[model samples]
Target: MMHDIPDSGDQPHLPTTYASVAVIGAGSWGTAVAATFALAGVDTRLWGRDKDVCDGINRDGMNARYLPDVPLPKGLRAFDDMAAALSGVDAVAIVVPSRSIRAVARQVAQHAPAGADIAVLAKGIETETGLLMTQVAEEELEGHVVGCISGPTFASETALGYPTAATVAFPFSYADRLKPEASPAARMAISLSTETFRAYVSDDVVGVEIGGAVKNVIAIACGMMTGAGFAENTRAALITRGVDEMKALAEALGGRRETVTGLSGMGDLTLTCSSTTSRNMSLGLQLGQRIPRAECFDGRPVVVEGEMNARSVTDLARRLGVAMPICEAVRAILHDEADLGQTFAALWARPIEAEPNAMDLSFAHPASDKAIQKLAERIA
Candidate 1:
């Protein structure tokens, strides 16, 4: 019963003459996305702010620092010159870390070709404005089509061409008018869709963004449970409770609750929580082991988005008068405001309530037949 914008099979192929794509940020996820586009026959250019990293990718076609042992496609190009990379590209994918999203967007806005549709791959709430990625793009890259791609994708696995699924979110009105002739940039959009990877479209931009941002924090909590030697029952409880926190936050931020239940929400939370490959979850494991955050994060250039998102999400929940005990506890642990034992005790000591209470009922009721019928009508 999930509402999705129909995929227009008419997405234009990359121009044989000179279709260009520039992917900002050459981190693991960025590199993976760039590789995917290149394999799909786009004239792909990957931009890394680090000259050495760019040189490595250009010379060896491998990003050893971030994604070691994975050879990039021959068609993938690397560039350190932001201006050269951005010049004349049909579309650009902004894949920088969450905390640096604004600064990177400004740089792209200044350099990327006019009228380019920016597909943002960065996922995190801006700590300063609490704006979702698309909002940040709208503020910085005015007049450009903004889209978001998010899900429970692991960069390493994605780079290796593992089958993966993700959601692409934009306005439904824009999706309705999507034709091969819409923009020269449309060529880049075609390469974005591929066989091994699938992208479902949605108009619920905020919902998708929230799902991508909030799930990482929940992943951290699940990791804590695992590191603490908790069993499957505990993990299941954490996942369920985590979804509640995510739905509450998503709803308060004007996102559809159903979006959180889809791939971006429940799907992402499950994947991140279950995998040690997740940076946020690994960070939590390290914290649970009593390792200092600085030591655990030492020499790690990649962003553990949940660490930054925890603060912003907690702050937003507080401002909106929403209950997010898990997020609040995470914030305390991250900021050293409380010890893990104290936080764990606080969580355990929380007031007992019915199995389904308050916001919990919102999720439970949706699976009922009556609710499904109502949702079907809404989507139809």
Candidate 2:
């Protein structure tokens, strides 16, 4: 059970802390999130599929496999039993690979505490369904508040208590604390935000999801440029055009235009595209250097969400009637095995057109908006 928030004389509805939380993965990001919660004095449980990982974390107070050299809080416990981890947990932060989100959601739906708020840190579109991570969660965790988070922090930096910021967007029902019964998601956000890590709230869940998902593919393209001996101008051009592509898709999918320019969008895009530490970027570097795909990531511990989402994102863009050239190029290179030189040439050879101002929100998608509203109503 979560502690009831005491009514502050000035702000009566804010929760200062959460009682318990479960981070549903043992990956570096998951371990870091669980550590944050535990250090915040919340009872936290980390659930991993591997028994050995759980045993190690419990025994050593560190997830040596994922977050080497980073000390974990004593209050943070690890469990292989999903049910045990969810016991008395108020919120669940899922940090599994994008490909595994649906399977994990199925397990969570069966075992999660009733009314627990759920958020996913995984960034990818479902290959078969083209659904976002939050959408998949909503499918399985019916009637539960489902949210998605995205932003610029690397797991390694975050685990060291370095400054980090993120954006978390939920369905409209959970966007504001209109009613105490409707505040579970808001409470989860408050508990997750700390001095070192900050989480800003939003109602544009679709925008946040799209931003997080597409940025990885863009990062791959940037990495390819870097590995191909391209100058900074080439990388800058890709990043700029990538933002336009993201904006177009996000707006087409009923997300606000401004959302794509915020923390989840531009912030995440910049970080992933520029950082060599990014798994997707590093994978792309290998690809650009002509390394076999299998060999590039053969023994890597992390799953490059960009590699998984490249095709799915391009497919989604086509389905939504949105143009995402950079993302498409990445898919062609990665999935279709197109030659990098040819792809780059083709991209540059495309006809030049006047750029549309992404700031303008006049383009309407009533059907998309209505569908999202209906979903929110049904779940609410």
Candidate 3:
């Protein structure tokens, strides 16, 4: 069951008033978040490492290189100088690729405004540190309040204002302390609006972070099945088993098991696996079709996060002695160490076990079973 966070007696539809916000990347996701804040009338500045991309957003009000068709709003500003972009901002969103999160966090430490709330939207585990995005923030930005926003969000869709749901996770204590600043407008801007797109806030930062990181790899696995023309049974099995793998990793990392079963875990895996827009899923589809990985991504601008995450996740799982067969199979395929048939065989050959054992079974009890039964009936 999801943990309930009592509304801190703040209006649910108000947007927080901030003097200025800085977005520290100009990739598609970064662009969308920056656009949203800019549309909300926040004095938002976006920093891109590429000079040409920055110039394009500043001059044409569009990021032709990253997001070609979506025109940025008039109020948004773009800059190539990271320090200048971060100066005096009330909040900073780090949207760099997972591989570069540490490096970017270091840069933010050097110049970001003191006491700014650092928000991490990037998803994936750091290979070297075996840390999630929020953990990286804690290590790099010691005093700042850190938060994460993640779910099955598609950047292109979100940029166009297509409704989507995601979880905003921060410490409950920190969120409680920020109650005075939480205006109704802030709540409206971030809250769940429709079934199509929503944002649920949670205090389980560890669970949310793990779900976001691990789902990319699982999505790739599902995409491979789709490309291979697998039947519905296969898809069902893969998704079910994938959740188990994700939960194991989450538990190993000190996250609540229930959080994995929530939006970031099961919800994210299901959405990414089924969606054609997911980069990792697309990459897996290509792999399933016998296309060369190098050729498939030959001219692509955005990196497939799953391809990068698979190795890091696999290494961490092994070090923790956690059974993450799905991620292991993905890593093998990426490294050309296992053929498609062998990978699938490995999955099929695993000894059958009860579903609850796939998760941290300690959370399971008689009452929990009753709750799950009721939830299942409701969905039915």
Candidate 4:
């Protein structure tokens, strides 16, 4: 929680060969990336909220609370002092929860070097402003370049040195700063990638950010289906349609359509929806078992980013005039006290249209559209 920067003499020495990187937030994802940076030979320091997690990481080389039994890279260090963590780093990775991103960005703005590149690992739209993580960073870290890294990464798997791939989208507005001679983005890409973790670079920040945010909500819906004993057909339908919902929102927000089908979108959606280790999906499982939302989170400290973003993302889609039925259904369930039956009922009542860019129903028999409309009306 160190807010202010000290005198210039207090600056930490950064290695020239390996970029100096500070990963804010010692949660699962943050710790995993810190370990990856260390493995990549970067000077990495993980900033944690509590002292015990930091103490354990520093003393035992294990994030006992987040990634127990997994030995971290020897070079990775943890600190409770935020200023000490951020000082003189070439890149800062904001891996804190979505809600905390803005505040952490402000803190980073104060302490991190002005030329340092930032990579946000937290996924989700801000509930208050309905802004994506990158947008939120822009607000608090004005004059600083912000980017995002997202994909099908489960923190535990990555911490265990399992093979993983992610996409990093640096802002194009920083083109001058990203020149081959002064390429912080290239350095960031190099620092993030390891033998086991591959990082791909992209320029479509909106597409990458939206894909990661929306998939979590879809995963929650998928988890509910699994818990309710729904067949694989239901799961498949959700996953397929969920990508469309994601693409719709991303396209509406000035992002490339193809980006949604890439690593940050389809890849992430598939991994999250199918895994019980996902915190968002696990929350959905509890709800699917008929547990009340309040009861499910009674004393748990885990931040379910999907639950936090469900309504906000739905609102964003609404403002953008994009239809996202899957996200809408998730919002209803999480914020409206809606049951599974009600969610399905609402989904069934929606107008049936041909999948986006599929066979043109207008050229096909008019009867086909009429029949689909009739079925939708009947369901309604």
Candidate 5:
């Protein structure tokens, strides 16, 4: 169980931590999260679908396949059976692919303790349902308060115990939305944060989720530009314009655009777009160099979320009457098989418009004010 936090802290920091937590997924991110929690003195158990991965973790003190070099603590447990892994825990975290979130969430709903709050570490819009991972969890996870934690964290660097930061957000209405007994979002943040991994609490759940989903698509566009030998100026333009697109979509979806400028948005965008280590960026690199589509999809170590989210994001944008030209361009190239040159030309040919006005992107909401005030009081 997670202990009560002190009455005050800085960086929205938590003084206490969870006694036990279960992380779902054995991939790089999942492995790193579980190991970090264990290192922080939590009784952490990790669940992966593959028995081999579980056996390897139990025997080697590492997830040799995903995080071969990061040493896991001896106390961290790994299980192939979901129920067995989550049999006892104060909270649950889901880190599988975006596409798998629904199925995994359903499974979690079936087994997680009634008091456990759910956190979504995966980043994507459900292609089939157009629901954010948190929303999907809310839909399937009755009586559970669902929140999101995300930033520019790269798994390898994080698992090796490097300093990392992420934004953990649950709506201000988190308690009212799910159940009366739901723990506050600040507590959820506390349960996952540690000395090295500091988590900042916020009430912008929509803003956080939108940032994660959009940054991956933006990274692919940046990668394509880089692979085609574009200079820094060109890349900067793409990232800047991508932020505009992101801000536009976030506002349309009832999220605060200011949140898009924070860790989840700009921070994540900068890392993914510039790093060749990113799966989405690497895939874009191959495409830019004229690699065949069939070949680009082959042998990737992990799900290149940007490649798949391209279509879903564009589709969502259209349904909501928002303009996300860059994401749409990426969708054309990857999914519609549009000619690269024509797509680029079409993307650059759109009519120039004034940059988004500040008033258009931000609004005051009585409910949001209450949420923000609640968060402020917790960390005061």
Candidate 6:
């Protein structure tokens, strides 16, 4: 019969270092992230602008608008009051769209504590600015230890407590100010990990951002092809080559190629591109069927980020001369009014050059590997 999450005295001792965390945005991903944090024994506050969604979570332990069927953790509470949701939290996770990250980060700066570490859970490039979500957060929340959390997490599955993993990357080092081995990102990774949700920490912030952003674009392309009646061979090729495109853009922006092979890159890319459940992929499917863009999202409440990200990502790639034919083609279809059939034809007819890059296709780094193993040991 209780509505809001019980007081601290009614809860068990928290497992993660962070005793409290606020997740802004009541959409699927945000709700999922907040739910898992609560299940992990953290005091999780979910902030939503929509009062109805907030009331649903507070009363029913579900976001009827975003995640209707799944029951959220008892330790999770939803708040319409942003300040109240943010008050006294040890960390914050901004789960808004990349386009809104700047504004939301500013609000967080105003409300969250001075020392709370922040992580961006959204995946996309700003259409107008071409800034990664993490960059936008860093610019808006200066002096905050900002990081990124991304991988192949589906909102429903992850929220339901299925096994999920993500790469948490923060470029700044805070060991001098925090615990001996605790970087802001390392702390974030630990705070986010649960029995079913594993966290991998990394410093390749740019790489992780690129992988997260571009994969959506690639997923759109795959959806287009699939909608056009293409089969497994083509889809598989797109995924494999899509990895190259993602890797190239990341390296052009000072991200490591190896990061492209990790959870945030290959892992997320595979799931989004292959699954019709993904909004980006599904949108492309509609477009390939010659449906109008306006009609695609007519009743959909969640934003399909790839639709906008295509423009900024294409522009950024061109500015840096990164060869991203697939992403560029996607932009053309979505923005330039290019016919889907012709675009697919052009992609197929393009000059076949020798495959570039050795395509190491492996993810390894001493620090990340060691830390992951240690986490497994602790959990086991």
- Please report the candidate that would top TM-score against the real structure: 2
Give per-residue lDDT, candidate 3, residue 353.
Answer: 54
lDDT of each: 0.78, 0.82, 0.78, 0.81, 0.81, 0.83
Superposing all C-alpha atoms, what RMSD in Å does each candidate have to the true structure? 8.6, 9.8, 7.8, 7.7, 10.7, 11.8
Q: Report the Cα lDDT for residue 289, model 4.
A: 68
Off by over 4 Å in 1: 1-18, 174-189, 297-302, 354-380
Q: Which ranges of candidate 3 are over 4 A from the true structure?
A: 1-15, 174-198, 298-302, 358-380
Candidate 6 stretches greater than 4 Å from native: 1-16, 172-180, 297-302, 358-380
lDDT by residue (84-202, candidate 4, tens digit) is 99888878889988988899898888888877778898899998889999899988887778899999999989989899999878765444333422344445666777889887767
> Between the candidate structures 3 and 6, which one is better when assessed by TM-score?
6
Estimate TM-scores for all models.
0.85, 0.88, 0.84, 0.87, 0.87, 0.87
Candidate 2 residue lDDT tens string, 1-380:
22233445755556546688899999899999898788777899999999999999999988988899998888889999999999987788899988999999999988888888898889989999999899988999997789987889799898889999888777754234445324544566677777788877777888998999999999999888777766589788988899888888898999987898999999999999888899888987777776778788665665788988899999999998887889988999888978776676566655545657633434334354444454333322
Cα error of candidate 5 at position 380, Å = 57
Which tens-of-lDDT digit does each residue in 264-340 have in candidate 6? 99999999988888999999887766677778867566578888889988899998988898998899988998867
Window of ten residues with lowest summed lDDT in model 3: 183-192
lDDT of 5 at 216: 93
For candidate 1, the 10 contiguous residues with the lowest summed lDDT are 179-188
TM-score, predicted candidate 1 vs. hidden true structure: 0.85
The window of 10 residues in a row where model 5 has the poorest summed lDDT is: 1-10
lDDT of 2 at 45: 96
User: Clashes in model 2: which pairs?
Assistant: none
Total residue pair clashes for candidate 5? 0
